[model samples]
Target: MPDHAISGWAVVLGQLAYLLSGTFPDGPLAGAALTLWMAVLGCAGATVLGVGVAVLLDQAPAPLARAIRALLAGLRAIPVLMLIFWAYFLLPMLAGVHVGEVQTVVLALALIGAAYTAQVMEAGFAAIGQGQRNAALALGMTPLQALWLVVLPRTLRAMLPSLGNVWVSLAKDTSLAYIVGVVELSTVATQVNGRSVGYAAQVFAAVALLYFFICVWIESVAALLLAATRSRQRRPLWRYVTLTAFRLARTPARPPPTSASRGSSRSRPAPP
Candidate 1:
């Protein structure tokens, strides 16, 4: 039984190696390398663009906010795969410009990610208390200063968990690049399976495991951050208690006025 198990395992490993080597070569640069690079670039570009959009949405006035909301809604309603296909096919004809499949995927992902980010940030901004802004203003800070120094930091803290979730969502969304011929992990896995006909299950299983590992890592980090934030929150409770006590201690005592000072009648004073 052990020997049989070992034989089965060897076959699986051999198949995996054959699929990988056939799909991507062992060199300084290869298909796997390109796929990873594209994924990283796509993810990073999306993040930066998304943050910018969020900032814009947070600062927009009512009318502009409505317009932006409508725009984002439309974008979000469209599927990412459809967006990629449209961009891949129509962009060149419309603008007389062309880009490779990976570039097209990155652009599409960034645009979609930015729309979602803006929405998330809008919620975060709305969640902040007005008293915080008022206090900042009372402290002689300008509107922008209040936003930057007080509102932004707090909003970011509040949004970190959501942002991490969004990032995981984006990572999964990268698999959609396969539709546009961008050789990301999913695409490479598909190619491997195509070449190794009987090993599709194993190939896809391995790919899924890889994605699971990535998500687990992200979640672990998020949990650590949340724990730290909780600790910070506990610390502030003590500070608040101390501050309240100090205010109580500094309150002044007043003396009662004498009966003569209370009298308002000039006639009584003359008689005295």
Candidate 2:
């Protein structure tokens, strides 16, 4: 390659490196580090809250279930940006506490993510069928035991792909944190673009590539986790019992033989 071409490529790489680092050692959190921090913590919070809410929604009384469903629906209806704004402006007043910009974004992301996660989990639970739990009950297991052993394992296994999608989406959505003045990756890229003349396309391309790679990494990890989950062949005692009972229930019953048919079989045997 020509020396000029090599120098141009080096300049592009240097710009990207500057954008990603963004005075990390000298200033407030910014760039790729901030983005990843928010995404990981936000998704973690979402998973825990979402899974818990799903279980509660499944087991709650009729009125409570309706209320929880309505709340989740409302959260889903709101945009992530709006949620961040609310968290940034309204939450402090409501709670009478000082919430940092970073914390606000993380909380907003978590709420929206949890709402989606709950819905996903609800679908997963529905796919599992009530029969699974009933089978556990019939085999002398308590409701909690049945849920923990028989129903949850199957539901999680079935929902693994969807949950992975949710994580990836949440990770991308962390960009919205810029609304709250959190200097994450996108913001740093924009700042770098403004300072560097005639390099907007390259700067933004770097940002896009960063996001692309992050999402790809998340998906790859999720796929590995899913494969591991599926490869697990060991079944707990409760699971084994419930599965056996379930299969037995689904098996078709044989009709009783008529007296004439029985007698015909006896005579036929003697003739043979």
Candidate 3:
């Protein structure tokens, strides 16, 4: 092995950086972009689908909810590799549609992530007390309103840590995108090794660090955003938008105008 491969760690780091520059001559995206892209898409779609499944499970009749739960459990039981194969090989046959390798990887991640996410979400929901819904009802809030304002917020609060964990897992799982020929981090690392024979350890070790730092970067950003929202309480971008939406849906109840009543009495009852 060359001394550059042994002692020149800086050279290795630089090569790693170049590999992850997220662009190459052939296309606009390479390893880093493609990896993070799949992670983002998978996490987003999973969150939405998981929440939807959770809601359905919560609202459906007993028999129906049990069926939904069974379905989710079945999904969770299936290996992610099988899910990927289904997306890549079986989905087109079933849906009569064609999606690229990128979409296939993302779809598999989302399908599996959603099942896991729903499991955590249901546990979060279970942690919540039913009395909260009653309290909202007592306060004249509709079921949907109570769900929107109270139940969901608390359930999400409980789910946040688990959701973060799931996100990290999905981010790392993007390495599996290589199986479908997606040019992600693992794929790039393999290519680099093919070129620099006998230094597979150095190339792959740097790639491993790259994955670690990418996940850490994502977690740092998420923590910062979470802190911002928590500190602001009602002033951050998401809060402002959610509050505005609720206000538009229905204004908070206000007492009748006491100033108007007082002014009308003074104008009409000068003799009294």
Candidate 4:
């Protein structure tokens, strides 16, 4: 029992070192940079595309809206792991273009993330009041101008928290890159465990902590941005108040005296 315990501890320490340092002989950054970069690019691209889709969907007619919703629902039903596998094995065959594991993973993640983001943004767009758009239109603004200046700002402000949630989900989904053998943090931990022989617990613990730190940092940044947006919204309230007061002050003290009133009674008698 003592020997078994000692061997187990040794394995745990070895795996822990590997997990901390990554599987590559050189270091964590050396092996992990490519995967991390891919994930970042995928998330950014997906967010942009998702926003576009949301804007388009918001403008779509009822029939089109129903179609788009159905399509996105189908996409959401597909598992991320299955998507990654399909992309890895079949994309090259279908397109006659080969890609590395990192590329495959990134593509799969981008598709999945975009679907989720689009749904979230659609809800955000729905939450915006129609009165805001009407007010913009009444100001002599075109439809596009109303959407860009008034609708988008309010929608994005409301969507910030949901967007933050999508980002967190994207971060976790990065681990799914392991399916295609992209050496992300999870992949690195898996490799380390394979080598260390039964130290999965320690390796996984370290990986989980790393992911937690990343998510916490992201949440902090999102919170700061939300506060800044709220501050900007409040500033507009004060401006509106100031403008209303100025208009009230500038209102004519009284209507201009009628021109006929300026004529004296003597001039009126001469005319008679």
Candidate 5:
């Protein structure tokens, strides 16, 4: 058996590094950087909007919750590509406004991500027994306080792994932005392949590995957050920030001295 000598690895590594770190000649982030920006914004928006929607749904009247649920279900059913087209094309026309390609792509991804994440969050929220929040309320906690400190913490832990998956999915979906002319990792890889000539498979494989590593890191961070959030449920920390703010606001202001008292004090001090 002959030992295979690895050849041309340096070129592959150089291309991957360039793809991951290079900026466009026009000074904008290119390749992986742009893709990362899109992913973080899309996933962050999704997490916030998804959690907010789920909370609103849980707290809403039965009929209203049902309506919201149906609406989200319908939105989630729509394909992501169509959402991109809708945002990139129809949205500007409907609103009589122009939006940048990057903004449109991120908005479309966020909307779809929010819809899917909302479903995951709703299920997590539902799994929580009401007895806990009810107990907090009985012990003088406001509904909002109980929800924030008690209900939300537990519910979030239940959903963190799932939410992490959504984040991973959102990052990969940034490739769809190519149709709208937003240059990101996958599009940039294609462009580089077209220009470089050969090593196309290797470049794409590098892109895949980058995505895989990023998703792994995201899940690891999510796991840590999940653990921290779980601990917060055991020892509620939300009140500390509010209490600190309350203490700061309660600080005593200086009182004004009366003119008569000031004159009398001056005279007495002179005698002394």
Candidate 6:
């Protein structure tokens, strides 16, 4: 690189501290730290809400289950940007409660994340099916016990990757907070680029790199957790899945009773 280019790059790199901290020492968190905080808070709230709602969807009455499913589908259909807009602009007017920009963004992300998480969890539950729950009940477990001990663990393990992906997506969505002027990483980069008009490419590149690093770190942590969970399980996930498929395949389906068989069984049905 030429000396002038190197000098410009060095000047741009020097703004890294500002991009990360963004008035943190003087004020509250504003840059990458704020983004991460939003993502974490959002994901935590989403996971809790999603799990509760998913369980309710599974166990609720058919009418109520359909309503809950419809609500989730509608929430998922809306864009995250629209959610943010609603939370920021309409929430105060409707609810008469004040919400800071950061809080508003986190709330929007949480709601949307919950919708997706619920969907993933619902699929996981369906995949495991009622057989596991029935087996657990047969072993003297109560309904709640069967859910907690037998069903939730397997479902969560199965859905971990999907959940992690949702979280990663949420982390990326934090960039949208910039639209509300929350001063997250992308916003900070924009500000830096505005000041150094000559180094726009470098500024954006750094921002992308920072986001990439955060997401990769999240994925790595998820992978480690998944590996640890697998080690603790009775069998690896793939083996368990393969064995389950074989069991299901080998189980014979009972034929429907013919008229003669039905008539004979009906006539000879009473035990001595």
What local distance difference test score does each model get? 0.70, 0.84, 0.79, 0.73, 0.80, 0.86
Q: What lDDT score goes with residue 28 in model 3?
A: 58
Pairs in clash, predicted candidate 5: none
Clashing pairs in 6: none
Q: In candidate 4, what are the lDDT values of residues 1-272, reduced to their tens digit?
A: 67765676667565554544454566434223444466577777778888887887878988998898888888889998898899888888999888877777777777777888899887876688788889978866677767866787778778888878877777777787777776777777677667766656655666677778767765776788788778854655654675466557757687777767776543666544
TM-score of each: 0.72, 0.81, 0.83, 0.74, 0.81, 0.83
TM-score of 2: 0.81
lDDT string for model 6 (1-272, tens) is: 58767766786779988888788789878778888889889989898899999988877999999999899999999988889988898988999988989999989999999999999999999999999999978866678767866788789889999999999999999999977778999888888988887878777878888898888877887798788777754566665685466557757899988999988988995777
lDDT of 5: 0.80
Q: Pick the candidate with the highest TM-score.
A: 3
Winner of 2 and 6 under lDDT? 6
Better of 4 and 5 by TM-score: 5
Better of 1 and 4 by lDDT: 4
Task: Between candidates 3 and 5, name the one with more favorable TM-score.
Answer: 3
Off by over 4 Å in 5: 1-8, 24-26, 232-237, 241-272
Tens digit of lDDT per residue, candidate 1, span 80-101?
A: 8999999999999999889788
Candidate with top lDDT is 6
Kindly list the per-residue Cα lDDT of model 3 for residues 1-272, writing each as its tens digit: 47766654554665665468545655657787678888989989998999888877777899998888888889888877777877888878999988899898899899888998888888988889899988977866777777777787778766777887888888998888777788888888777778667677788788888888878877776676556545634564664686668666676677877998889888895674
Tens digits of per-residue lDDT for model 5 on 1-272?
Answer: 12211232445676775587556665677788888888888988998898899888878999999999898888888888888888888977899888888988888888888888889988886788879988978866678767877788778888898999999898888888888887788887887778666556666777888788767777887899888876835554566776455556757777899999899888785544
Better of 5 and 6 by TM-score: 6
Model 6: how large is the Cα RMSD against the reference? 11.4
Off by over 4 Å in 4: 1-36, 233-272
**Candidate 3 pairs with clashing backbones:** none
